[model samples]
Target: MTGHFLSFEGIDGSGKSTQARMLADHLRQAGRDVVLTREPGGSAGAEEIRRLVLEGDPDKWSAETEILLFTAARRDHLEKTVWPALEDGKVVICDRFADSTRLYQGITRGDLRGVVDRLHDQMIACEPDLTFVIDMDPAMGLARAKGRQGTEERFEDFGLGLQERMREGFLNLAHEFADRCVVVDGARAIDAVAADVARITMDRLSPDAASA
Candidate 1:
């Protein structure tokens, strides 16, 4: 049996996590088996890595070092969480995936995208079957993120400038991977955005659509 792998990507506080949960709940209500997860920590080992990367100062690790750390976590996550679910024909919804690394540690610091790509190809050569890129204004995203007052504010502490660049990067990725990436407008009400996501995902999950 095979399963679908879906990922949500966007600048921080774009509401991707909420949407991920909503989608999981929707799928479950529809009687579909679903596994919801996230990164830079999904599995046990990766969760430990998550704190190291997400709780420190903004300068805790260079972008290059971050790339390695993220890749390591991703490999562990796939082995311990994602792969097993997919093997069981369970729909796997991940809050963030390699694309986040491709941006956060790739171009945000400098032009280390090549390094990120190479490392990913070598150690974590997997991609979600479909990706939801929640598009939002950088200023709004940062403000919402700060309002959360979470300890994992290392990335948020980078300021609005980082979010702006990451926004552009995510948009560019939608074009680059148009086949599997769908950009969802995230400025609307929660129900509205969730409705759109459910409609789109249901269509993708349809038997005819899958067979096509």
Candidate 2:
């Protein structure tokens, strides 16, 4: 049996990582083999790139340079982690993926959507079988992100306005990729959001659906 690829995406503090873990745990309990990973640090090489891109001065790299670095990390992640796990029939649950690049870089850099898309098509052309975009208000999300302590404060440091733009970008992506993307209300309680994620994931991974 082939495995399913699912990714969780959202603003900085929309609880996407927690939900991704929850779904992976839930599926594992249900007897499915699950590979819970994240980008742009899923593989060894990617992790190094992650530090360069994430733990620096916000302006450490130019917009174009940042995009190139992200794409390189993604390529390493796919080659070393994601593709191998999928080929081995393990359900792959990623905390974030290429869509993060699309939204973050697309919003921060001017007129870079075309570059992002072209890079994706040429280098990283795969999408998750299902994507859960946890929707929430930028204000609330920023507040939550501010509570976190990490050197990865580069993207989180974008503040509320950028977060708002990112929210819109993600929502647009959900609509654009309606077949594989689902927007979940992330403002609710953690358990509530987890329940929704699990249910939707099971629906897609069910035997009948799988054989469809």
Candidate 3:
């Protein structure tokens, strides 16, 4: 059986990362071979690129330059981490993926959605088998993000305005990729959200669904 690729996406502090980790733990406890990783720093090379992108000032690089950096990091991640684990038939749960770029760069960086798409098509032409977008209000999400402390605050520091825009971008993307994207309301309790994610994931991984 081939491994399944699953990704979790949301604006910063939408609890997507927590849900992703919870799902990974759930799958592991159920005896599934799983590899939980994240971008833009899954593999070593990608980690180096991640620093370049996530550290430094928010405007350290142009939108186009940042896109290229992210694509390069993703390429390295797929080559060194995701592909190999999938080839071994291990479920790969990524915290974030290309959809993040499509939303973040596409929204904050001016009219670069077309360039983002083109770069994705040319370089990282892969999508998760399933993606869960945790939807939440930007105000609440920003509050949650602000509670955390880290030097990797470049993106998180964009504040509530950008997050609000990002929320819309994610919703639109969910509609655009409805066949493979599932939107989960994230304003509820963490356990409630995790339960929803797990149930959906298991249904998707069932024999009938997998064979389909």
Estimate the TM-score of every prediction: 0.96, 0.95, 0.95
Model 1 clash pairs are none
Candidate 1 lDDT score relative to the true structure: 0.91
- In candidate 3, residue 110 scores what lDDT? 84
lDDT of 2 by residue, 25-80 (tens): 88777777889999889999999999999886777887788889999999999999
Per the 3 Å backbone cut-off, how many clashing residue pairs does candidate 3 have? 0
Best-to-worst ranking by lDDT: 1, 3, 2
Angstrom error of the Cα, residue 4, model 1: value is: 0.7
Predictions in order: lDDT = 0.91, 0.88, 0.89
- TM-score winner between 1 and 2, please give it: 1
Name the better of 1 and 2 by lDDT: 1
Report the Cα lDDT for residue 153, model 2. 85
Q: Which stretches of candidate 3 lie over 4 Å from their true place?
A: 208-212
lDDT per residue for candidate 1 within 61-120, as digits (tens), equals 998888989999999999999999989888899999999998998988999999998998
Q: What is the C-alpha RMSD of each candidate to the true structure, in Å?
A: 2.1, 2.2, 2.2
Best by lDDT: 1
